[model samples]
Target: MAASCGRRRGRFAGGGGGPMMASIYSMVALVLVLVACVELGDAAAAVDVYRLIQYDLAGSPFGSRLASLNHHAGAFPFAPGADLSRTAVIIPVRELDLSFLRDYITNSKPLGGLLLLLPQKISEKIGQVRNILAEVEHLLLHANIPYPVYFAYEDDKVEALLMDIRRSDIAGQPATATTGGFKLVVSSSEPKKVTSPTISNIQGWLLGSKGEGDANQLPTIAIVANYDTFGAAPALSMGSDSNGSGVVSLLEIARLFSHLYSNPNTRGKYNLLFGLTSGGPYNFNGTNKSFSDVAKEMGVTLGIKHKKINVSNSRVAWEHEQFSRFRVTAATLSELSAPTELLESAGGLHDTGKLVDEKAIYRSVKLVAESLARHIYGHQGRNIDIFADNSNLAVNPHYISSWLNLLSRTPRVAPFLSKNDPFIAALQKELSEHTVEVHVQHEVLDGIFTFYDSTKARLNVYQVAGVTFDLLFLLVLGSYLIILFSLLVITTRGLDDLINIFRRPPSRKSKAV
Candidate 1:
């Protein structure tokens, strides 16, 4: 009997008498297995996210760019180009302090060309502005950047700059005058408003065609570029890194795409609009109206929506560092969310590198436009449309018009044909009658945005990247197994003790008798 007990002990310890120690070792091994499985699952999840990004960027002009991007996967590498046109009436509102731009140019290579849309109050400074602009341009010319530095004088500078251009008798007079000339003046007398008159005047000046028929019929794309402010109102108001960085990124992106679409290497198949908006009393005002107006036009436009992420904590430094060093890669409108999960598990635009430059936004826009155009039109000739949601600036065309009053002071309100009460009701009714399809991609952190196309009747749900649904599932399963296994070990140990007692020598039984 004693020998039997010893044999049982030997079974537990493998030719040793330390059965209890062996049981403890088994518990530790189980723990180690749990950790190993979790780590393995995590490694698998990271790999999946990488493949997903690659899959999303497979075809299009961006695909060519993607190879370079992939090589610098953890860095933000810039593509060479800017988007400006000879026939296009470019306008920029300099509301922020120009210190950032000035420093950007002085410290780094100056921006080759820019068409600034300045208010009338700053008209007197045209000479000073021109001198500074000239210096920037002169430097770029010296650098032989290949792209010409173009300028559009606005406000009083429009007439003033026109006189200067006409007097200078430059070689590229027509190209310079039309592209650089202030085509429309925001009549000094007009009230600040995005009024119909303003919209009409600016549209008439820039577009030269009237009605929906004349609007850029080519596939249209819109970008809703704005500052992603944190929850704090003051922070948003200050346009801190979130606001300033965000807007700069948008502008850079717009400039880049504008250049590409007009490039000789590229054929302009789509008409793209970059709406730099104001964040007013309301959230997302600029983009909302921009979207509404496009939908009302009944023209198909691809929409690329992007904003700054609230830098809530210092951890964002990593993202900033990554962004600064050019570790950040772009995604099409479809791929943006998915990567948010896989790369940055926190799922917000925190940069561990350098701050995301405005250039990144431009690159992203270019990529998205190229991809969508290719997807919709392919080799065949088809129009493309894109719409970007800006801030409330879209809603208050009047405010926008007032702001641009220095330029064409036309009261401009790009009203939402979609948000109009009557229109919404009509559309809702129309939608009920027709087979409209809606696609929604629910992100783990960010709320979902749905895409609806009545004409196609197709919908797809998108999941943002970086989110570990698979990893999450494995974690749950692995946890459950570990708990169950531990409990079973404890129960078996207890059972073995009972059996050993029963098999003990007969002395105890004889005493009981």
Candidate 2:
């Protein structure tokens, strides 16, 4: 048995490492080829991104036109003529230059995609960056951008990606197939047109005590407020102040009256109608009817701006105008003496909950409630503090803050809200608690304006290795493997055996023996 084993071992040694070496080299080569073909684009990261608004204005495309993105990252101050059509530019909102941006869009320059970085303190940025953002938003909203535009709050991960991209950009190396750099990818289906988007108007009526006549037939004191908001980005349009403040104030007033009207002894003679309208962002597209003070003691001024409604203007600026069009006697009490342009100030990027002053809302609520109560109780011009501090009728700061926070967190874009949206349901429920005959009317947004979906998406940013780098890596690896394979053959067998692989085998002297 020992002799047989020794002979087998010698036999194997004679052809030592030949078969094994060939097998190992083939495996190595296969692995190298596989590695070379592997793309490392998505090995870096993924981020949550809010897409820029994608909508149609009477068949005219506006805002960011694309929903999908797949391209390498390019940084701000991009090198001139850098083939932006294939590069996804990373622009910090802080570094935006309105003139250059306007020129870029106005001139119709093409880009693969754009990622706008928003500061973490988006709420605080209203005063500092509101103009810049609003201008940029207006520019982007009006123009037809054929590339994907996304907004991401600046965080550590995004900062890293931006730094990496900016470093490569500063080095004058545009991210491309041959040169490695960051790539942004957003995978989404084609944007579908939102069909028959519905905005529901919630209204409630509080009937007063009957004075030998039907209270329902009494003159209605209508308090109307449009609760919906629109913005460049639908998902980010948290209309915290515009109509949110108005809505909160209206609800508080309704609650106060519900308490008073609950008792016949304290009920007013005038019927109260509370209407919470929607589509106010679209010239008060949704309505029912109705129609502020506490300005003096709170160091607030009461100023009313009345802009004559041009019959030929064909645009409605204030909520009251929608009522006035129906010949209903209406007046607007607002801080703005002048109206904003179309789609302007309807809740844009700068509007946030943090900027909402609860005290201001509280004061407004108190003012309106007091004036309305005075008129109802036949003491409108009196200086008595009816809803005084710590009184049952006093405004609730907690309630105002709570509702304001809710509105701030909710995206009130009409087209995107569901038929039975929770926010709308909550509003309806709250109204039902304070008044009778609470009605919710769901109506399609009528007008030339049409909106598209895909208002939000996820963005994946990758630190990819370029094809050139991959090729070089494979080349070096292949060379190393080849050298190593040869060295193994020489050492395990002999130099003679390795040389014989390259040399032609000598022919035997056939039959010479």
Candidate 3:
């Protein structure tokens, strides 16, 4: 009887354990399958996020230049249609003078669009260039000329196209030469005229002392930076190179000075005024307005007791005037005759008002340069000799590229300043000196504005498929059903024995035996 009972218990145990084990195995497999699906879903989402799209401009014979023009110009009537436009005129930067532009626009046929090709060298004078372009556009609008205007920065493809066009038999010919052919067209919506114009200038001051005495009693120093750009449509003209660097540098100076001023231990005696004026590109419209406002607000005349430092990349230096001794590489010299080069060489520096002394200005500039050099190279740094004609100003040549919205790739050769640049490091150090008092005034002027129609400015939306909670819920539900089914099968198999044991009553007391 004992042997038979042991066999029965063993069979019951095996029957109950089999389904439980199988359920455990199923759960492990299901978990692994779910994990793999999740990983695959993540990979697919990542692919969708990183997808790239390529734009081709092979349809136009002028290629990228034509494409860029079309992109900037917006909508315009094309040739071989009702309009009898002749030449697709391209004006180089050198020939982009107001007179030249006006004449071209006035004389252009109904379908002919103007293309302005800018050179890399124009980076320094980008503000001036933008101003000139704006004037050109304004002239066109004022004259009611319906011709389209387009602009492109210099590139290899553009240069090639210019060379081909120049070498062609139709060079300098009339529009009839290339009539009825596919040509680049650029146009923009007519500008709205402003009748009641209200101009605002940004201005601020930082005082070294909290004295409420007469403003004339305190010595004043001003640091000025321009914060405006040539408003270009396609480019939006962020003014990176024009005054971006100067503004950034000035702000940094202000931050450092503000911290220093707050500390009682490092306070100075002189009052500092920091001005970030707008309208620099528009004949100093914003800057002049700011100075006037600042003087009136302070109730003091900025005169002999005041020192003003114009902090811009576009400053005139004595060294630039004596260009005979300056050494430029042959490669750079070859392009010196280009429009950008002519503009730079001829207009690198401008005259400041006679209020400041020349000798004092020279000494002050030298001191600043020397301080920078010392900070950059430590004791081993070369002496900065501003008096020498050969000494070049520490001005960066690629100021134009710094504008954030120029829509051009960085040049291969231009050495942009990084955190590692000695100039930046040294400038920071110099500004941190507690002896100097710095104040900053921030102002926003009219920006380089661009007009975009509904088509060109449309937003692109992308749809991506991802794992939803519903799918996960369904997976969990299926796993739970499998688990529950296994549990039910085990219970059903053991149900008979359990009932027999319970109903059999205490196995009749195998009495004394």
Candidate 4:
């Protein structure tokens, strides 16, 4: 049977292959090519990495400017006078050295890149180290880093790779072109300027009872909250509390008031305006001021400070400044004693749902809703509970929490958000449900701040070998070759002939052993 099969194969090969045979061979070759491609892809692991915020604030560069990196991996305790200009340092947040980092960045040290590894559950650890992380975040966000700086949350796969890299680093065998260590590669296009960044401001009106007069003629009470957040990493800036709680409070107030206006008996005489504004980090800020009095009555002291708008300062610090510009009365209600720094608390690395208290937002809703009800009914400073806990129109903690969580997960950076972004759409839809009318106004931000693209990237980590490793490998290979060659000489000739090669030619003056 073997002879017959061999004859058949030989005959088939000897003869011109048939169409079927050619098709089979072609398919096999294609599959082999696909397998080779698959192997190449498997060699590198991709990790989701968020790039440091990149933008030009009035032509002054801030954040990381570069967006691409291809360099060998490195860690702490680098050799003295080591050239890190070609090495991408991988520093875990657990081992973050703030002073060293600040010094390096402040001095504008040359570097291939920077990769900050955050814990998988950074939200869980932030509360304990808020101050430390805030300093790091504030420093990074405010500086103009020339090199690409990326942040990635650590996972099991990346942790394992990091361990290998640490071992290589400790062994004094950093991976180079010829060495075996990890190499981070992020292939991305050059970031381009965002053309005419626009922000959407959503507004709604809860029509008051029209008693023999035009409804538009009635006095309107506007409740506004800035919905956008700014931070070190635009992709992670979920402003849960800075303004999310305020935004949710406005929505909740709208809902409670909508119920009152739905019935003629309980309708207020004044119109209610709900505004979800953007660009809160800028001077065009959003205020939850109307909720302060009610909040104060409920054991929450909300201060409504009066900051004079300086038209010549060029920096708009408060959201109420815009209202002031139009000669309108407005106040920002905040729990903070003072104004936050440029990008502080507007949302950044540490502002997740974990830090936000849903009950706090719930309280804000009650404060605003009940206060407005009292003011309309001429019951100011009274103990009447318009939205009592057990009433059908009571404040909804679940509603506040759901909206808070949604905002906590959504990135609301105004420059990156579309005028009709789904988040904005959701806001519009919710307002339309609770108010008589809703409108979305899109405004192009003046050329004060220009933003760039490529907020996030996938870093491809590849294992590479070191120059020292290559040298050691060549030495072993050479030794093996010599032994194999010597064995060949012995088999072909004699043992003495192989031995003579290593014994060295006997000197004429001395007898060889």
Candidate 5:
């Protein structure tokens, strides 16, 4: 068969072919074809999935937040129904490597989702980490794979980011008095009324804090985006935890609830509002005066009370030593803690729920809201809760402390200092004051992928069966070339041997005959 086939192709001299040679060549070709198919099948089965991590100034709060489905997915593949899929449990962070993600994906085997973390700026400390994450994401998309993603953060940390840097510096300066700093000089031509206020006339002077917002504006707050910049303060910043993170958490919860309120499936029974405050390198000045200013405006415009308003400072220490030497007094602590507890009690969640200082503030805010809801609904109102959902509370305590030191040392690089020329003296002063506080800080933010339910989205693998003719043709051509080469060598050697026999043995053969 092989000889006939080779003859048809003019690959050999077509004459002295035998059945055995034909069978050998046929078997050789079949084995080669089978080997090629097996190799191709193995290659196809070795497909890969990539994991991506993203980070911004703060950790990726959005990435760390696990979806409801995540819990379900995590509870899979175990006899006890414990999903035990640690892969989906560990949120993707922006500074992880492809190998790490690959292993995680393999172990968990998720039902197609994607986790998007905040974008981390390329810096010397983490450029390589960021690149690896990017490459993994690229590869996964290339392979047409999907996965779920989430992010998380605490609110108080964001509050620190939004602190009024100008005020902070001025307050810390030796030239200040009474912990006093720059004061706002409000200039207005409107006359102030002593008691009886006139209608449609600007006459109110708000010296106290009270609800100034409209009754209809859904109460909302901003949450910090999870990033490395949040958490504990830098050494230079006096190791103060910024309350901006707290504010951020509040905002996010409000935003999320607002989203829920708008959803057709879960809408109504709640009103939500949100506001984005300042964060990042410049300092917390942006959001520092936002609430107060808003309240003042409301009091002036509407006949509302604005009194006893204390903007929760994210710098409030949560630790015993920090608190012992902190500016807050025991009486103030009592007041703060009491209100927080009251709100918690009002929310009807529990009194034993414990968290860090900023997280406590977040809980307090939610509790306050819940309390108000109960007050409006005969003390048996439904639960209306919120959280500083994005927190590195899951991280190691020592790491948190070091991060606090870094923030303290971050230098007043904003409103008070020029971007081109840092306030070297001020920075030097902060560093020198906290020289012993410097430590390595690692901020871990969660990365996320989501497989949302309903008709909103869907994921399924669609495969088309067809022949890979090009590869097949290439393999066949190469096999044929190899066989043809072997045949040429064999035929050449045979011809040479035949000629030699005919020329040298002619006399012996004639004698024998």
Candidate 6:
């Protein structure tokens, strides 16, 4: 009887194990199948989106420079076969300026559009480039010229093509001679009106005093930088020089202050204001706005209420320290002038001492920098001090559209701030030490970028052919659900059987014994 009971128990166990094993195997198979199907579906649905952008490979002297300019312009120059009546004149950057623009508008024939070719060399004199572009835009607005002005960077291949066209059209006539007709004409009408300029000001502050001080009453130390930049032509007006270094430095300084002043327990006595102003190329428009806002918040009129704020006054004068391009000195200006002379002499052109008045331009830049600095720190009055690095002065003549590309090939030329610059070292020291007094004898200068000639483009599209949903995905899901249900049923039945086996009133024979 014992042996018979043992055999019955074994048979029951085997019966239960068979369905359990089948269910486990079925679940594993379903999961594997589902994973495989999902992956396959994902692969099938994936698509690659590509855009066909034409580049002036042969026309551009430097491949990257032209590519960058084209990217900024949003489109390539009009093709040769394009309608000339609807096209505009292409002016080289060298020919663009206040005087040249005035002459062109007054003397040149009616035009449909204008394309200015910016030179890559303008990257050296970014501030002057911006100023020139701004001056150009101002002239156009004043004259009420409605034609659309576009800017392109100078390219060798494009220039060659243009020369060939001119040669063919003139047919043995001197290249310098003009037919006296309209150089460019288009069907488009004048623009209706000029839109208002948009200037954005970014500001933040850290409380340094221990008590909850009235922000308006506290003496403020403002650290500022310009965030906007521009190039000469619309295509080359990338203000990387102004926006990249100056703004980056301001942000770093702000971050350090934030970390230091964040603790309420150890706050300093003075309030720290960080201002990152935009519209740098537009006569420091952003900075001007910032000053106005600061005045309003501090409850004091900038020039009226306070000629200079004293520590005893309820509204103490605000101290401003601005970070900008290095100041240009007399020696540097001379060095910059030497290059132009050397270039003209190299081209077999006589040095007329009038190639370009480098001294006058440098002086103008210096004056502008000084005036802007004074305006920013005017509140400080007699107490104001401006410090900067003359060696790293912002001087990029090729910032506009011109034929010259001065960068060396072996070691590509670029605008860079040295790690060991004394100005940088001094600024860093002041920030790290949190010193209230900083002394440097150098003058402060601001760099500007042109926004008038810049362009923007958007590339967003979908490839409809690649999107798909397959039956295999559904099949795999269905199989998974079915396997899951089967496992649930198997588990329930196994538990019930085990419980019944244990609950079955002890066999009558065993009970009787």
Cα lDDT, model 4, residue 157: 84
What TM-score, to 2 decimals, does candidate 6 have?
0.34
**lDDT for each residue of candidate 5 in 165-242, tens digit (9 for 90 to 100):** 223433443112223222211111221112221111001110111235543453322122111122111111211233
TM-score of each: 0.21, 0.85, 0.34, 0.82, 0.21, 0.34
Candidate 4 residues 212-283, lDDT tens each?
Answer: 999899988888888999888889888888778888898888898888899998888999889999888865
Better of 5 and 6 by lDDT: 6
Task: Return the number of clashes found in candidate 5.
Answer: 98
Q: Could you give candidate 2's per-residue lDDT for residues 198-271 as a string of tens digits?
A: 88999999998899998767888899888888887888888888778888999999998898999989999989
Per-model CA lDDT versus the true structure: 0.30, 0.81, 0.37, 0.80, 0.29, 0.37
Candidate 6 global CA lDDT score: 0.37
Better of 1 and 3 by TM-score: 3
lDDT for predicted candidate 3 compared with the true structure: 0.37
Q: Ten residues in a row with the worst lDDT in model 5? A: 197-206
**What lDDT tens digits, residue by residue, belong to model 3 across residues 387-489?**
2333333322232223222212211000111224343333334344423333332233233321122112211111122245446657987887766665555
Q: Is candidate 4 or candidate 6 better by TM-score?
A: 4
Our model 5 lands, by Cα RMSD against the true structure, at 26.7
Q: Against the hidden true structure, what lDDT does model 1 obtain?
A: 0.30
Clashing pairs in 4: 178-465, 179-464, 179-465, 179-466, 180-464, 180-465, 180-466, 181-464, 283-316, 285-319
Highest TM-score against the true fold, candidate: 2
Note each model's CA RMSD in angstroms.
28.5, 5.4, 22.1, 9.2, 26.7, 23.9
Instruction: Report the number of clashing residue pairs per model.
Output: 83, 2, 12, 10, 98, 31
Please list the residue runs of candidate 4 whose C-alpha ends up more than 4 Å from where it truly belongs after superposition: 1-42, 77-80, 285-296, 311-314, 468-513
Model 1: per-residue Cα lDDT over 180-235, one tens digit each:
22222111121121122100000000111223455456544444333222110111
lDDT of 6 at 49: 13
